[model samples]
Target chain A: MKIALDAMGGDFAPQAAVAGAVLAAQQLAGKAQVVLIGTEEAVRPLLQEYGPAAATLELVPSTQVIEMGEHPAKAFQQKPDSSIAVGYRLLHSGTVEAFCSAGNTGAMLVGAMFTVKAVPGVLRPAIANFVPKLDGGMGIMLDVGANADCKPEMLEQFGELGSLYAQYVLGIARPKVGLMSLGEEEGKGSAVTQAAHQLLKVNPHVHFIGNLEGRDLFNDKADVIVCDGFTGNVILKMAESMYDIMVTRQLDDEFFARVNYETIGGSPILGINDNAIIGHGVSTPRAICNMLMQGYQMAYAGIVDQIKDSFKS
Target chain B: MKIALDAMGGDFAPQAAVAGAVLAAQQLAGKAQVVLIGTEEAVRPLLQEYGPAAATLELVPSTQVIEMGEHPAKAFQQKPDSSIAVGYRLLHSGTVEAFCSAGNTGAMLVGAMFTVKAVPGVLRPAIANFVPKLDGGMGIMLDVGANADCKPEMLEQFGELGSLYAQYVLGIARPKVGLMSLGEEEGKGSAVTQAAHQLLKVNPHVHFIGNLEGRDLFNDKADVIVCDGFTGNVILKMAESMYDIMVTRQLDDEFFARVNYETIGGSPILGINDNAIIGHGVSTPRAICNMLMQGYQMAYAGIVDQIKDSFKS
Candidate 1:
């Protein structure tokens, strides 16, 4: 399977993107292909050091580049040949099994919507991440800002997506899902949270664990946490900030030395047709490597296929 | 100053509650007068252990205890002489300068509102807690489930209360007040967060630091973080869950050693007319000691006076 790479994306542009892709392909051997997309001239120099491995790295020519600040929809329309747009187009047109980019998220989401389209029955395609928990397991939180203002129905869909992700990707059977709320009691949240709580209670597919308040996240009460994009995003971002702060403040030399970015890799973009994953913008080489490995693992896990089947069934 | 303690509150009612008060009075020395409000028989045995220090402790007669499942308003009304009710009455009738409880949060909030009353200009009092950043510093997020459904104007007041708390309690001069939202952009967040963001920007007394998302909590970008109780509570609880999970997973030894509740003490009731601090139900001896110390400091800080001044000025 080939992974469409957005060579013109991210702060480091073609250099970091191309270098990471070459390293990924080398590590994966001939089992996978890296189809680089962007201006040939810009990507060629970075490909030079790969030697024989460089031959396996394919390039798709594109003329335009989407500036980071460009309006998402406008940039996609105006720069259809941009690396990000072209990468998604390749996946949309079935040129590759998956697509990867460290591009503007708004543009990426917009592209995903206009190009690949949302999974059928899924109201919103959520961006989720794994948060390490006390039980030596990680919890999956969905709608972590994919759709900021979600309807009651949208939250219900997020529960399914979060549940399915944990079951397939995280390997949690009958993953317990919790609706994020202010209080644990029934009818104890805003209209949105309260209504969502009621829906989850009656929904048979979800292993609804009643209402979980803010402090309950750290507890092993639920395996898959669900909320509207706005609240979920806030929770995700806050947790990320706290983790970063803790690592910076407490973790010492060896903790991140061998396993930094270029090592652990990226987060899988769930609900997409392909295996596109996103990394932290500030991802190091080690983290990028890990992301590549993560992408490989996800593909092997058939997360996308599982999601497709779940959506269908 | 005397503090009315509700001994019949919390899951460990009258047992841990009585013990915590006895411990608090001993720890406070002669600095505070303690009034343990509960059935005299239930508290007397626990008070027996303190003996001399227990001399500073007195029993205020109360028969009924508000059960967690009982309706807060209805229960409080029916049991006017309940522990929580008596505690509030002591605070209101000027017999006690403050009241503290580890009871049902709904009951506490209701008791606070109808008993001690809201500070003069305060629209609503919020449940405020310190989020311990991995950095030695902390962030204060308010309205954490106090007023789940809030309007734009109430959020502005929350910002003010948060700022005042940071200034006097935390000692950050001209505390950078943040309005929590989906993102930091001026136009970001839901309708209420956005509107609150605009109002905070112009409020003279508040050092409005623009919008902050969840990830910003640990960045030290803002000294005082403000959001409606619903969102703030979700963020706080999620961050808390992350902290609990990370520490337990990575620092097992430290987790056990620092396993006591003193790591983060109880939350304080802000925007009230009296000095009231509500602790976590899972309070340990160390946690109770720390909470009592905090209650003392809050009294010393004249937080109630400052809140009153906010209204008068």
Candidate 2:
């Protein structure tokens, strides 16, 4: 299997992306290869500095670079030769099984939707993040920032999408799906949540576990929690900030350490035809490695095909 | 000043309430008196155990109790003699300057709306929680769980309400108000947030600071962050769970230690006709004391009157 990495993405891009590609290549040797897409001149020196492990890397030079602050849709359309744009082109043309970026999230989302397109029967694609569970496990949460204002049907789809990702990608045998709400009761939450809960309850594809509250976020309550992007995004950032605070205050602990974005690397944009992972813009070498590893795992697991099959059934 | 305590509310109930009343009585002295409403038989003995500190306590026997699981509006109507209901009555009848409880949150909200009512010109009343900032100061966030689905106008009001609370109750001279969004940009939130941002930007009453992302929750970026109740509640509970995880992991530090709900005590139900503080259901005696102290501060500061004046203009 081959995964394309956007070398021009992220704050420490080119260098971090090169190092991550090198590390991922070493870790997934014989199993997968990485195609680093970026300006050859900028990436070659770093690849040489990283030494022997960089041997597995295949650089696909792309001249254009998408800055972090650029409009995603516009940049993806205008900068066809940008690393992110080139990476998407490779995935779309079946040159690479997956593409991952830590660059402009908007551009990544735009590229995924416009390039590979959304899965059939999918209302909208969702981006899912892993919640580091207290039980030394992880739970998948979807619509982390994709569709801010979601309808009941959209959220119901998210439950199925999250469940499939949990089972196929996260390897949870029977992913317990939950609707993230203010209260645990069925009647609680906004009109959207209440309507979504009703629809999710009868959805045979997902093992819906009713409603889960905020307290259950890091607990072993549910394997997949679905919420509107607005709510999910807030929870995701708040959780991220919590880890930041812990680090700033030097409250180093095993669980808190796992809360770092570097551990999970990036979130996958589910319901898309092809696999695409989005990393934090400030992703380090380790984060990049994990993100690439995640891409390799998703590609190897054939999650996209499985989701399509599930939707068909 | 007179403050009413729902003695029969919360998991620990009469014991914690009586203890808190005693503590508050001692702390307030000539400044204020506490009126504990509950079954005389259950509260009197606990108050007696605490001795001299209970001198400023005035017991108002309530015959009923609102269980945590009961319907808020229905319970308030059915159990008119319940501690929460009677406490509201005291505040409504001007028998007490303020009312507080750690009971069924919905019941308290129902009682506040039915009895004291929302201040004139207020779209909806909001509950504001204190976010302990990393800078050793605190910020206020509103609509924590009151109105799950809010209009742009309501969020605009929340900004004003949160700002006033910060200035008057929290003692911030010019509370900088921020609209909590997925991104920090002007047009980066849900439709409601976008519209609210436009309204907040020109609302001269508030020190509108554009948009604040979830990462700014514990930071010193804004003194008051406003969002819809649904998003606000999720963030609040998520933050609470973060603290719970820290405690469970024994990750003790100055900042993490300050994350304790006991430190801030309770959240005030803002935009109401009178001050009403709501504590966590499982609040300890210390939490209860802090809650009552918060109620005392709100009443003493004449926050409700100031809010009324602001709305009138």
Candidate 3:
């Protein structure tokens, strides 16, 4: 299997992307191949600088680079040869099993929707992030910013998607799926949440654990928490900011340290026909390496087929 | 001015509530009077244990108590003589300038809306909570859980209410109000937030600073942030949980120490006819004391009249 890395994306650009690819290639040597996607001139120098690990990495050059600030839909349409577009093209054409980027998140989403498309019977594809738990485990949360406005059905679908991710990738057997709500009671949320709660409660595919509040975010109460994108994004950003505040105050603690973006690396866009992972824009080389590893893991797990099968039944 | 406290509310009720009222009465002296509202049998013993400070307290006996688990609207309607309902009745009749409770939050909201009512010209009443900032300052966020769904106009009104609270109660001059959004860009949120950003940006009354993301919650960028109840509630609870996580881990950091609910006490129901503060249900004596002090400050600031005058213009 081959995992395509967007070399032109993120603040660190080709340097961090190339270094990450080399590291991923070395670590994932017989399991998967890492393909760096960017301009040949820019990526070649970084690959050379990475020394012997570069020998294991394969380079797939593209002509254009999408600016971080450009509109995703417009950029993807205008820059056909851009790294993100080219990477999507490779994934769509079966040249790579997965495509990963730390670029314009909108462009990645737009590309995934137009190129690989959503899995059959899926209402809307969702992106999920890892929530570090206090019990020395990790939980998964979905639609962090993928769909800012979601209907009740979308939220219900998120529960299924999140549950699958936890079970297959995180190895949580019978993952407890929960609706992110304002309170613990059954009818204690917005209209969307209340309706979604009913849907999730009856859904046979998920191990529904009722409702979980913000206080249960980092606890071991739920293995997979589902929410609309707006709420999930706020929770995600707030958690990130907590880590930032802890670092700025120089408070050295194990739990806060685990909150770093570098530790989780990237989130996978679930429900899509093919695997697509998105990393932080300010990703370090280590973060990039983890993202590549995550992309490899997602493809190896055959998540796309698993989701397709789940939705089919 | 007289402030009413619900002695039957909270986990350590009667004891914590009575002790808190005594503390407030002593600290406030001639500035304001504290009235304890509950059954005489439950509050008298606790007040007596408080000794001399208890002598200055006023007790308005009520027959019923609203349990924490009871439905808010139904309980407020069924138990008309409950401490929360009686407190509202006193506030409505001008017998008390402000009312506060560590009881059922829903009951308090129901009472505030049904009894005292929203200030004229206010689209919707909002509840606010204090957010401890990294710069050793405090910021106010509104609509923490008042209305699960809000219109663009309601969000615009929240900007005014939050700003007034910050300016008068919090003592920040010309408080910068920001629309809580997923991103800083104008078009970077759900449809409601985008519309709210436009409304808040053009409203001449507020010092609108455009859109603020979740990271800005603890920063000094905005003195007051306005969001719909759903988003605001999630952010508020997430912050509270952050404090909880820090405590459980025993981080012992100065910033984390400030995140204590005891320091902030309670949130006021803004845009209402009279001052109404809601404390944590598991509040301690220190938290109760702060809640009563906040009630005194809200009444002392004459926030209700100020909001009425501002909206009338």
Candidate 4:
């Protein structure tokens, strides 16, 4: 099996990307091969520096790059030879099991929709981020930024997508899904959440745990928390900010250390037809390695197939 | 000026409320008076126990109490003499300059709406909570739990209301009002926030700043952050939970210590005809005392009158 990374992605690309690919290759030695897709000129020299360590890593040449500031849809269309575009092409043609990027988030999302595409029955694919629970376990929150304005049906679908990922990837048994709202009471939320709550409660697909307030994100209340992308995005950024604040204050704690973006690697674009992960723009080598490792795990677990199966029935 | 408290409100009421009233009374000795409203039997003894410390505090008998779990609108209508109801009556009749309760949150909101009522031309009232900025200063967030669903005009009004509070009560000059969104770009956010952004950009009542992400909450980006009630409430509860986590871990940090609910005491219901604050349900004496002090400050600043004037124009 081969897992791919966009070597020209992220701020410190080529160097960080190449270094990370080497690290993942070492860890996945007997398990899988790691592929790097980028301009040969930028990546060849870096691979030479690693010499034997970079020997296990495969290089796929792409002449163009997708600058982060360019329009996602426009750039993805114009730069067919871009690393991101090529990575998607490889994944689509069964050349790689998974594709990962620390590049333009919007572009990565656009590629996921246009290339791998949404699973047959999925209304929309959601970006799922990991939340480090207080008890040292992990939970997943979905629709992090995919569909900012989500319908009740969309939120209900997110619950199912997150639940499938939690069960198949995270290995949480009978994962409890919670709808994010202001109050825990069934009647206490915006019109959309209130409607979503009703749909989730009766759905046979999940162990719906009713409403969850924002405070429940890090608790043992549920393994999957679902919400509109706007709410989830705000929360994802806020939690990240809090972690940044803790670091700036030099207040080190085990749980907070887990909150760092690097540890989790990247947010997976769930409900897509195949495995694809989006990393932070400032990802370090360690972060990139973790992201690649996560990509391998997703591909090995075949979470995409599980999602397709779940949505089919 | 007279500031009234619902002695029978909150979980630790009577004792906590009486003790807090004494603290506030002492602090406002020459400037204002503190009035406690509760069943005489429940409050008189607690006050007597304080001896001379409670001498300056005045008691107003309320025959009924609004339990935390009671239906807000129904209970307010059925129990006209409830401490929360009595407090509002006093505020409405000009017997007290401000009214505060840590009781049934819904009942408190009901009383505010049914009694003192919304200010003329105010679309709806909002609950404003204080956010502890990373800097030593404080900023206020509004519509924390009221009006879970809000219109674009309502959001624009919230920005105006929060700006007034920041300027008059919090004493921040030309307070920057920020509309919370998924991104900092003007074009980002939900349909409502997108439309609201346009309204706020040209509204002369505020110094409308561009969009703010969740990560900007603690930064010096905006003095006033306007969002829908659902988003605001989630953020408030999430912040409170983070504070709780810090406390449980016993990580002593001055900045996080300021995030404690006791420091701010209560959330003020803005755009109402009179000054009204709703304290935390688990209010300790310290929290209650701070709430009363906040009430005194609001009354002194004449913020309600300011809101009325702004909306009137």
Candidate 5:
């Protein structure tokens, strides 16, 4: 299967992206084809630095690169020939089996959603990030800023999606799903969270584990933590900030730094029809490599298909 | 100045609270008096453990104690003579200079607000927690759950109150204030947070450091991290969960047995008319003592007066 890569994405675009592609190609040993999408002028030089893998890798030339700070939806529209837009189009047209990017997150989400569209019966695309907890198990946080406002039904769907993703991808059977709320009790949180909590608790498919307050999230009590995009994004940012602060304090600097940069290989964007993954824009070769592998595993598992099946009931 | 202590509050009640009061009295050296409020039968034995320091501490009898799982608002109505309710009333009636408890958080906040009332011009009372950061300085997060839906004006007020508390208590001048949002950009969060961002940017009295996402709360990027109670509580609980998860794994024992307990200190309830501090219910002797001392400092610093002045503008 051929995977489309956004070569011109992120602060260290082309160079880091291309290097990561080469590394992944080497690791996969051509079992999977890497198709780099970007302008040849910018990418060829970076590709040449790789020496051998550069020649073996395929290049699909695109003219523009979306800047990180640019308005995401508008940028994708204006820069139709940009790597993200082009790569997404390839995925849409079925030329590529999956797509990955370390570009503007907003742009990537917009490109993936508008171009590829959501799977049938799915409410909206959700971005799930792996948060490293001390339990040796990661907490899957969903809708980590895909859509800000979510209905109760949408939240239930997110819980189901998160549960399935955890079970199939993270290898947790009957993964316990908890709705993020203010308190773990029956009548905790705002109207939205409360309603969602009730829905998830009663849903037969999801291993609904009642409401989990922010404090309960890190416990091994729940494998999948579901919240609206706004709260999820806030939680994600909080975890990221803590890691940064802890590392900056020089507390086991290398350990936390590796945990911060290396452990979280990538955040898979679930709910879409195709295999679309978005890695940290500040992707090191290692993080990108992890994302590539994660994408491969996710594609093989047919998580999207499982998600579709989840909605069937 | 005299302080009323709810000895019957918290899981370790009477014992830890009595010990803390005795320690506080010794530390203060007759500067502040301690008035323990609880059932005489339950408190007398615990006070005996303090030896001579118990002589300086007096007891005011109360028949009931609010349980951890009890409904806070109704508990006061059902048992007005409950130690927490009575202690707050003592503070309200000017019979005591301050009241300290390690009781039901909701009950504490309710008693304090319904009895002592908010300092003049304060829209709402907020629960502020000091997050120990790598910078050696603590980041104070306010409105951790007191008021979920806050207006831009209220957030500005929260920022000012948080800043004032940080300045007087923590001794930071022009304390940096950050509005918590989904992202750090100028227009990145929900309407409330985004608008609060704009207002904070223009507010001159505040150090207004602009928008801070949840991740930045743990970092020393700012001294005061402000958010509505709903979001703030979520972040607080999430961080708390992180601490719990880490401690449990590090100790590898039963959850409660694994907790350091020593670090589970009290959270100061800001914006009340009087110096009233609330500790976590499961607090240890050290945390309760620290909070008692904190209550003394807050009372002596004329924190309410300073808060009164900051909001006058």
Candidate 6:
């Protein structure tokens, strides 16, 4: 099996991406091979610095790089041989079991839509982010930024998608799914969330735990929290900010430490046809390596097939 | 100015309320008076516990109490003599400059609509919560839980309302108002937020700073953050939960400590004819005291009159 990384992606691209891919290659040696996609001129030098470790990494050449500020859709279309576009191509062709990138989040998401596409019965794909629980272990929340404005049905599907991620990738036996809302009561949310609640409750695929307030995010209440991208994005950013503040203050408590983006690595675009994860823009080598590990877990779990099976009806 | 409180409010009521009111009475001694409204049977005994310090407090008796679980509108209407209802009546009849309560949040909101009412030209009233800024001051966000759903116009008004609260009550000059959204760009939010973003930008009433992400809440980016009740409520609760986690871990960082609801005491119902604050359900004596002091500040600032003047056209 081959797991790919966009070597030209992220702030410290080529350097951090090449180094991290080398690390993942070392760890996934027996299980899967690591592939790097980038312009040969940029990646070869960084790969050379890794010496023999670089020998384990497969470098696939591309001529262009989709910049951080470029329009995702246009850039992906016009720069067909760009690292992101080429990475997606590899993903679509099943040449790589999973594709990971730390650059151009919008482009990565746009690439997902244009390439591997959504699962057959899935309404839309959602970006599922991990939540560090207070009691240890991890939970997942979906639609972090994939679809900012979602219908009730989309939110319902996010629940199914996130639950599948938790159960398959994260190894939660029967992930408890929950709808994020303003209040704990069934009726205490916007019209969309209220409607989504009923859909999730009756959905047989998940262990629906009902509506959860923002305070419930870090608790033991739910393992798979579902919300529209707008709400989930707000939460994801807010949590990141809190962790950043802790870092600034130099407070190193265990639970808050896990709140760091680097700890969780990246968010996976769920409900899609294949495994793809989008890392933070300022991802360090460690973050990049962890993202690759997560991608490996997702692909190894066969989570995309699981989603297709669950939503087939 | 007389600032009224519901003695029967909060989980530790009459006791905490009376103690908190007595504390406020001493603090507001020469400037304003503290008024407590509850059944004489419930409040008189608690006031007696404060000794002569309680003498400074003016006791306004009521016949009923609004339980936390009762319907807000029905309870406010049926229990006309309930503490919250009586407090609203005192506010509407000019007997008190402001009213504060820790009991039955729904009843307080219902009573506000029934009595003092939304200020003319204000689309809807919003509940405003204070964000403890990392820079040693306070910023405010509105529609925390007042209206679960809001229109573009309502969100625009929330910007105006929150800006006014920041300027007058918080003593910030030309408070920067930012619409909370998934992204900072003008085109970056849900349909309503995007529409609201344009409304806020063109409105001459506020110092519009464009859109803000959830991470901007505690930062100096926006002095007043405008968001729908659903988003604001989720952010507020999420902040509270983080504070609780810090406490559980015994991480006594000063900045995170301010995230505690008790530190801010209460959230005020803005865009109304009179100043009314809703306290935490688990209000401590200190929290209740801070809320009353805040009531005194709002009354002293004549915030309601300022809001009326701003919207008079």
By TM-score rank, best first, the candidates go 4, 6, 2, 3, 5, 1
Which lDDT tens digits does candidate 3 get at residues B222-282? 9998998888888888888889888887777888777788888898999999999999998
Question: Tens digits of per-residue lDDT for model 3 on A150-220?
Answer: 99999999999999988888888899999998889998888889999999999999999999888889899
Cα lDDT of model 5 by residue, A92-132, tens digit: 88787778888999999998789988888888879988765
Query: Model 2 off-target regions past 4 Å?
Result: none
Error of 3 at B115 (Å): 1.3
* CAPRI quality of model 2: high
Candidate 2 lDDT tens digits, B105-195: 9999998899999999999999989888888899999989998899999999999999998999889999999999999999799999999
Best by DockQ: 6
What CAPRI-style quality would you assign to candidate 3? medium
Which regions of candidate 3 fall more than 4 Å away from where they truly are? none
* Residue lDDT tens for model 6, B186-225: 8889999999988888999999999999889899999998
Candidate no. 3 TM-score: 0.98
Residue B168 error, candidate 4, Å: 0.3
Residues B230-249 of candidate 5 have per-residue lDDT tens digits of 78788877676655654544
Please identify model 1 stretches exceeding 4 Å from their true place: A133-138, A167-173, A215-220, A250-275, A290-313, B12-15, B26-30, B133-138, B246-264
User: lDDT tens string, model 1, B116-215?
Assistant: 8888888889999876543456668888878888889999998888888888878888888988888778977888888888898899989998988877
Fnat per candidate? 0.91, 0.71, 0.66, 0.83, 0.76, 0.88
* TM-score to native of every candidate shown: 0.89, 0.99, 0.98, 0.99, 0.92, 0.99
Q: Write the per-residue lDDT of candidate 2 for residues A1-313, one digit (tens) a residue.
A: 8999999899998788888888889899999999999998999998888778788889999999999999888888899899988998999999999999999999999999999899999989999999988888899998999898999999999999998888988899999999989889898899999999999999988899999988889899999999999888888888888888777767778887888999999999999999999999999999999999999999999999998998884
User: What's model 1's lDDT at B83?
Assistant: 87
**lDDT of candidate 3 at residue B168, scale 0 to 100:** 90
The two-chain DockQ for each candidate, comma-separated, is 0.57, 0.81, 0.78, 0.89, 0.53, 0.90
Candidate 4 on B68-113: residue-level lDDT in tens? 9999999999999999989999999999999989999999999999
